[model samples]
Each structure stands twice: as structure tokens, then as C-alpha cells.
Target: MKILAFSDLHRDKDAAWSLRDAARAADVVIGAGDFGTRGEGLADTFDILRDITVPVLVVAGNHDNLAEMQAANRGWPHLHVLHGSGVAIGDTAFFGLGYEIPATNEASWNQRLSEAEAEELLAACPDKAVLVTHSPPYGVADLQRNGRHEGSRAIRAAIERHQPQLVLCGHIHHAWGTKGAIGHSEVHNLGPAAHWFEI
Candidate 1:
């Protein structure tokens, strides 16, 4: 199926508009994360996404209010919020864990898990799955402005152990691209806008 992945739009309507149009033409659209500005304007933020014509699979980012987001998405068949959940789309099975690492300060939400907890989530998915997370795993596509890598050690370990088919994520906007593979999984970070690929 054709999958379009993008992230960190952070409520940019122009980008959302483009994505909405692109999404309608594709089989499915995946929003990696950072969909809204935290601490305010949630109602309006969801209004933007509610217009999407195709199936939209989203994972909450550090910038979103999960409770509010969950409420907003109620009864929307086209939009599935994958916050610690999995959804199937044609030939692919999409599994997601949003905000699975802790942030140092305010303006972010972190939910880091132990190796066992990580494994339990991975175990819940079928082998060779399409995994999605807000933050990229360490040493995969996670890079800082100075080229330093900042990602989850546990996440990396999970990928090494499970060997998922493809991983789609975005938390570090600077590392807005793709890394051929990490462990046995191919990793892609679609940040700051829209991108499409055949999977």
C-alpha cells in the first residue's frame, strides 16, 4: 500500500492542507507526532485534523494533550489515534507507542519504559510489523543539531530484538529524514512536513 508519513507540523494549516490532499489520494496517512501546540488551543487543533478525507493514523507527540486528543477523535472512522495501541491497514499492521521517553523539563511529555515493558509492547505485535513511535530509537535516525544522537536505548534494544519491517517516527525535527536500517528494521523520520513512500 502507499503510505505517507510526516510529523512536527505543530498545527501548521498549510502543511495540514497539503497533507490532507495527499492523504486522500494515498491508501493511508501516518502522522508521526507533534500535531499540536501543548497547553492550549486543542479544540481548534483537532478541528484541523477532522477534515482529513482518508484514514489517518496518529500517535500523540510531546506537544499534545492526550486526554483532550482522545476526546476529540471519538467516532471518527477515518482517524485512528494510536496511543499505545495498534491498528491494521490492508497489508500492514501499524503498532504505536506515543511519548515513550521522559523529557527533562516542561513543554514535553515523556513515558520511558523499562526493557521488559518495551518487550511486552513489541510482543503484542505480530512479527515483521510496522512500528511507530514519537521518538526515534537511539542511533537510528535520532540526531541533534550538533549531530549528536538522542533517542531511547530501550527502543533501540526492542528493534534489535524484534526486527520489525519498518519504523516510522519523529520527535527530533533536526533529524528529519530516513536512515536505511537500525538493527533489522528500516527507520524513517518524517518531520517538519509531508513525505510519501510505497511499503
Candidate 2:
């Protein structure tokens, strides 16, 4: 299937418009996270999300509250909000998580993911499924000032323990356009912007 993935949009509705254009030619469109102004912008984001003509899946960023996202997606068939949840897209299963660990330079939205939460989510995912998240796994797509890497150790452990087909994430804008690997799974960082690719 063809899927268009993007992240860290920061409330740029034009980017949403551009994504809609990409959705015209793809089977699915996914918004990784940071879709709002510090997670408070879901109200506006929902309107744009509803306009997508194709199936769309979304994950909350540190900026987003799980309850708020759920309420926004209520009764929406085409829009899906996954928080430690999974969805099947054709032959692939997509698993998603929303939060990242706190970094020295980067700020976190709320509580970071604990080992237990990571493991639970990983265990819930289908074998060899596609993983979707708001943060990158450690030493993979993560980067630091002076080029150091700062991804999530818990996330890395989950990928190592449960090798999925593909992992998609965003949060660190610099990570955009970068790809990495964990076990047999390929991980992508869509950054705070939008982009498209074929699955």
C-alpha cells in the first residue's frame, strides 16, 4: 500500500493542505505528532484531519493529551487516533506510541515512557508490524547538538525485542529525512514537517 507520513507540523495548515494533496495519490496518510501548538492545537488539527480524503491515522506527541485526542476522534470513522494502539493497513499492522524520554536539550511534553509502558505497547503490537511513534529510538534517528544522538533507550529496547517491519516517528525536526534500523525494522523520522513515500 502507499502511505504518506509526516510530523512536527506545528499547526501549519498549509502543510496539512500539502498532505491532502499527497493523500490524493496514496492509500493512507499518517500524522506522526506535534500536530498542534504544544499539543493544545488538536481542536484546529481535527478540522484539517477531517478533510483528508483517504484513511488517516494519528499518534499523540508529547504536546498532545491522550484523552483530548480520543475525544476529538470520537465518532470519526476515517480518522484514527492511536495511543499505545495498533491498526491494520492492508498486510501490515501499525503500532503507535506518543511520548519520548526527556532529553538534555529538548523539552518533554509530560511524563516520559517508562520501561513497562514500552514493553506493554511492544507486546501488544503484531509480530513484524510497522511501528509509529512521536519519538525516535535511541542511537537510531536521534541527534544532539554537535551531532550527538539522543533517542529513547526504552524505544530501542522495544525494537530490539520486537522487530517490526517499519518504525515511523517525529519530534526532532533534524531527524527528518533520516532513516535508521533496529534489528530487522526500518525506522524513519518525519521531523516537524510533511513528506510522502510508498509502502
Candidate 3:
């Protein structure tokens, strides 16, 4: 399947709209998160993404509220908000976890989780499935401006244990567009720009 993936939009309506054509060309659309600013305007982002006809899978970012995003798009078809869950589209299984580690950062909309919690949530993911997360795995595409790696240890553990085929994430803007490997899985920190991948 051809997947058009993007992340950390942060309420960029123009950039969101620009993804329509790419979405049309892709089999699936995956959004890592940060659709809104400080948990507001997610509906507006959804409105723009509504142009895509294919399945759209998303995870809430540090700037978003997962419950609010789901509530705001309650009636919207083709958009699936995933958190500690798996959704099957065609023959592929997609699993996701949102937000940053609580110990790393704090924000009103940031759905923070502990390392153990993240590992427990990811434990349910099936092997070879697509892992979508708002935070990158530890030491992989998670470098900050100060050169510190801000990533989830649990996420990295899960990747090492489960060996998912692909991992998509976006939180560390400085690390955007970067790719790394964990075990045999490929991990990408997709920025606001759309990235194309075939699986």
C-alpha cells in the first residue's frame, strides 16, 4: 500500500489543504499529530483533512487533546483517531500511541504517559504492524536543539520487542524528516510536509 504520512501540522490550514492531492494519490493517510495549537482548532484541521477520500489515521500530539479531537469529529467518516489501539485497513494493521512522555514535557493538551504505561499500551500491537506515535523512539530522530535526545524509552522497547514493519512519529521538529532503524523496523519522524512510503 502507498501511504501518505505527515505530522506536527500545528494548525497550518494551507499546508493541510495542500495535502489533498497527495492524499488522493495514496491508499492511506497517516497523521502523527499536533493538528492544533494548545488543544484548540482541531475541528478546523479536520475540516481541511476532510478532502481526503481514503482512510485517515491520526494520533493526538502534545498540542492536542485526544478525547476532544475524537469528540469534535464524532460524525466524520474516514477519520479514525487511535490511542493505544489497532485498526485494520485492507490487510494491514495499524497501531498508535499519542503525545509525549510526561516527564519530558508538560502541556494542557499533551496526553502524557509514563514509560511503563507506554510499553503496556504498545504491548498489544501485533508484530509487523504499522506503529504510529506522536513521540519518536528513544535516541532515534529525537534530538533537540540542545542536542539532547527526547524520545520515549518504552516506544523504543516496544519496537525492539515487537519489530513492527514501520514506525511513524513527529514531535521533535529539529528531527523532522529524519529516519532511523530499530531492529528491522524503519522509523521516520515526518514533519508537516507529506512523505510517501510503500509497504
How many angstroms is residue 49 displaced in model 1 relative to the true structure, after the best TM-score fit?
A: 2.7
Candidate 2: residue pairs that collide: 8-192, 39-63
Best by TM-score: 3
RMSD of 1: 2.4
103-187: candidate 2 lDDT, tens digit per residue: 3335445525665666676667767877888888889888855697777777788788779877888877776888989878888
Give the alpha carbon lDDT tens digit for every residue of 144-186 in model 3: 9999999999999889998999999999999999999998999
**Model 2 accuracy (lDDT, Cα):** 0.75
Which portions of model 1 show Cα errors greater than 4 Å? 43-45, 100-102, 106-123
What TM-score does model 3 achieve against the real structure? 0.96
Worst 10 residues of 3 by lDDT: 101-110
Model 3 RMSD in angstroms: 1.2
TM-score of each: 0.87, 0.88, 0.96
What TM-score does candidate 2 get on C-alpha atoms? 0.88
On lDDT, the leading prediction is 3
Per-residue lDDT, model 1, residue 169, is: 90
